[model samples]
Structures are given as structure tokens and as C-alpha cells.
Target: MSSVDATPIGAGAKARGAGGRRPIGLLLVAAPVALVLGLIIWPVALSVFDTLTVHGPQGLEFSLEAYRFFFTDGFSLRNLWLTIRVAAICTVLLLVISLPIALYLRFSETRLAGYIQALALFPLFVPSILLAYALIRTLGPNGTVDTLLVAAGLPKMPTPYLTPWGPIIGLVWDNLPLTLLIVLAGLANVSRASIEAARDVGAGSLTILWHIILPRIRGTLLVAASFVILGLFSAFTLPYLLGPAAPEMMGPFMRRTIIEVDDPVQARTQAVVTFALCAVFALFYVRSVARSRREQTS
Candidate 1:
């Protein structure tokens, strides 16, 4: 009787279970996937294509002229070097400022902690243009900072912030909140148990931080640094607002080619270079994440 009743019921049950998956799952995901491919992936692919072609008043010509021009262009090396320097300095400054705040928030129970965090994040709400204007008021000649410096017997002390260094300061200020938030999130995941155990075993605060906390949050730090680097590369508003008359950034270069020169091809070429830089960073970030995961797993 049992043999007669056996009819591969489990196979049919599995088939029904597979068929019951909500179709909305695919629809929900497909739209975003398609949109990204269409808007971002396709345009990036097209920009690379555009960079390979030469443009004239007459029409487009397929050539290596764009790539050739990039190498021989004025300030190509100088401006590129400046951009990297700005990004590197900003990343380092941001990490230095943010990591301490993040650590404080993680370990301290001060009554003002939440307020301090809120203030830190409040800068994010301020527009870059407004921030630049404010900085100009505070640090410009005859401004509050300069006024205070003169009153403090430090006349002829030019505000280093008025030069390219000024823009870097603004970049750091603008980027600090986001980096702090990310680092704090990573810090929160650190094991209090481990910290306490270290303390119990006669480890000093510095030793515990060096031995455990930094290693645990190294991935977060790398990710934050990557974001800052990419943001600096793509950023235009802050740099343009704060920069001197001869502002030099990849963004301004792209803008000039597109808007002033009426040459989309050159703009596309600059964009391709920026994309390549970002791609290198992205590959590094992916590898860093993979290494972190392997370490955690092992």
C-alpha cells in the first residue's frame, strides 16, 4: 500500500515552491539595473568611444588626436599633479580629524556627544557656494580671521587659505562630516568586550587602539578615503567657488571644452581620463574589501 502511494510528491512540492516566488522581485530589481546600464554604463562606454574620435567644425573624425592632445596639453601634468595632491591631502586631513571624533563618540559618554555629532553633520546641509562665501568673509583680507591675526601682533601674515591651499581647507571641511559618519559607523562595530579584555590585561589605551581598533576599521578608512578621492575628482562647485582667477581642475577643463570651446569631444576625452582614474581606485577598493572579507572569514 505504501509503495502504491509513493508518487514523487517531494518533486512536485519543490516545483510548486519554485513557481511561487513573487514576480515583483525581478521587476523591482530590473528597473534600477536597466536604468544604471542605460544612463551610466552606456554613456561611459560612449564617452570612451568619443574620446577615440577627433572633432572639427565640419564633423567627427576617427583618430588618436584626442589621446595625443591630452599628453601634450598645457597644465596637463601640473593640474593633474595638483588634483592628486589635493585629493591626497584632503583624504589624510579628513581621516585625521574624523577618526578622533569617531573614537570619542565610540568611547565617551559626554552629555554633549549627540550635539557634537549633530553639529559635525550640520555642515553637510550647507551649500558649497555658501561655505566658500563664508570662508571668504572669515579669512579674506580685512576679514575676521585676518583682523584677529593683525590684532594679535601677527601682521603681514597672509592667509594661506587665500591660495590653492584655501580650496583644500574648504574641501576638507566639506568632506569631514561624511567621512566622520562612516568612520564612526565602523568604530561602533568594534568589540567593547575586546577593548575591556585588553584593558584588563594591562594594555594601555594607545596599545589597544594600535593592536585592535585600527585593524578592525581599516576597511572603513580605505572606503572613506576612496570616496573623498572620487568626490574631489568630480567636484566642481566648491573648487570653482573658492579658486583664484585661473582655476585649474579636471572639471573646469571639461566644462571649458564643452561650454566655452564648443567641443564635446575634448570634454569627453577629459571625462574618460577622470573615469579611468576612478576605475583604478574602484579596483583598489574592491581588492581591499576582498582582503578584509578574507581576513574576517579566517
Candidate 2:
């Protein structure tokens, strides 16, 4: 009688099992992927095609006139520059403001941490339009702040309401919750044992943060920066309500081009250009995430 082999299943069998499940995973994701392709990818492709072509005597001739106008026009260049500047400033501010709050919440055992987090995330529940209106009421001319300043016999201070700083302030406030959350998520990877060990080795809080915490959370910081920059680039409501009329951010600039200037092609060009800029940061974020995963796995 031949004895039956009692060997356990090998790697090859495991591989076959995984391969069998691949189709099921793909099927699960197929619907959302199809929706993204239909809703986002198709519209974007059409916009790009529109920006690169024009209706001529020959009917739908290829042209770069829209892009040429964007690159050469002074007003368009100014708007683009203003958008970049505001987004950069807001990204920096978000990182600066969120990191400390995240650090405190990550290490503190106090009861107030929950309340502080709630307050920080309060803007998430408030509608952007309502926030813009509230900002206008509180920071606009003769609003709450100005009223209080006048009541105290202090000279009226310069408000950010209609200046470039307006959008910067609003964007920073609106994005703080997300930035803090990302940083906190990153902080979770920092083991208490490592921190305690560093403290035992005479490492101060600042030293531990610089040497250990910041290094571990660097990827998270990059992700937050990329997200903030992308959101600010495409932001409309706050910028529209708070920002200056001239040299508008790309969001308002695009809308004005379409509505007031009645140039859909030019507006599409602006959008494509904005998307290209955001894509660069998006690529950086992707690379950072990939590197982080590789490090974790290895």
C-alpha cells in the first residue's frame, strides 16, 4: 500500500490562491473605477481636446491659441502667479500650525485634547460659503474686529478681507483639520518606546522631535503639503468672496474667463495648466507614499 504524501501546501499553491482572488478584487473595484473614467477622465480629455483646437473655416482646426494667450497675456500671467503665491503661503502656514497641534494631541494624556481637536476640526462642518460670509462680517470693514478696535480707541488695522491675505487666512483655517489629521496619523507610527528611550538618553523634547518624530512623519508632511496646494489651487468660494477683484486666483480667474470674458477655450486652457501644476505635486506625493510603503515592508 502506497502511503499518501502528508506535505503541506507550498508557495506555489498560495500563489495560485492569490491569483484566483485577483479577479474578485478587480470586480469589486470595477464600478468606482468605471465611474471615475466616465465622470472625470472623459470630461478632462474633452477639455484638453477643446483647448487644443478651435472652430475655423475648415471646421475644428487644431490650434494652440488658447495656450498662447495664457502664456503671453500679462493679466493671465499675474493671475497664475497670484494663485501660486497664495497656495504656497497657505501650504506653509498649514504645516506650521497643524504640526504643533498634532504633536500635542499625539503625546498628551489631558482631557482637553478631545475638545481642542473638536475645535480644530469645527471648520469641517461649517459650509465654505457660510464661513466666507462669517469672515466678511467679522473681518470686513466696520465688522466685529473693527468695531472693537474703534471702541477701544485704537487705530483701525489693515484687514485681510479683500487682500491676497484674505484667501491665505481662509484657506489655512479651512485646511487645518485635514493637515492635523494627517500629521497625527503619521505620529501614530512613532512608538512610545522609542520616545521614552530617547528621553532616557537625555534627549530633550525638541531634540527627540527633530531627530525622531519629524523624520518619521516627513512623508505625512509631504502628503499634507500636496493636498493643501492642490485644494488651494482649485479653491473658488473663499477666494471668490475674500480675495481681491484683480489678479485673482486661478479658480476665480477661470470662472471670470468663462462667464465675463465668454472664452470657454481659454478657461479650459487655464484649467489644464492648473491641473498640470497640481499633477507635479501629486506625483511627488505618490512617490513619497510609495517610498514609505517600501520602507515599511522592507
Tell me, what's the RMSD of every candidate?
10.3, 8.9
Put down candidate 2 lDDT per residue, 1-298, tens digits, no spaces: 0011111123234445456656765565566668889999999999999999989998999999889989999999999999999999899889999889988888888999888988988988888899898988998888899999999999887888999988888889898887887778788888999999999999998999999899988888888899789899999999999999998999999999899999888899999999999999999887886687578569
Error of 2 at 118 (Å): 0.8
Q: Worst lDDT window (10 residues) for model 2?
A: 1-10
Judged by whole-model lDDT over C-alpha atoms, candidate 2 comes out at 0.86
Q: Residue-wise lDDT of candidate 1 within 1-298, one digit each (tens)?
A: 0011111234344344456587665555566668889999999998888888667777977888887887787756566666777788888999999998888877878889878888888889999889888988887668898788878998745764446777888899899888887788778668899999999999998999899899888777887788778889987876776765354677666787799989887788878888888888877666776676577569
TM match of model 2 to true structure: 0.90
Q: Report the alpha-carbon TM-score of model 1 versus the true structure.
A: 0.85
In model 2, state the lDDT of residue 175.
89
Candidate 1: segments with Cα more than 4 A from true spot: 1-21, 55-62, 288-298
Cα-based RMSD of candidate 1 = 10.3
**Off by more than 4 A, model 2:** 1-22, 56-59
Q: Which ten residues in a row have the lowest lDDT in candidate 1?
A: 1-10
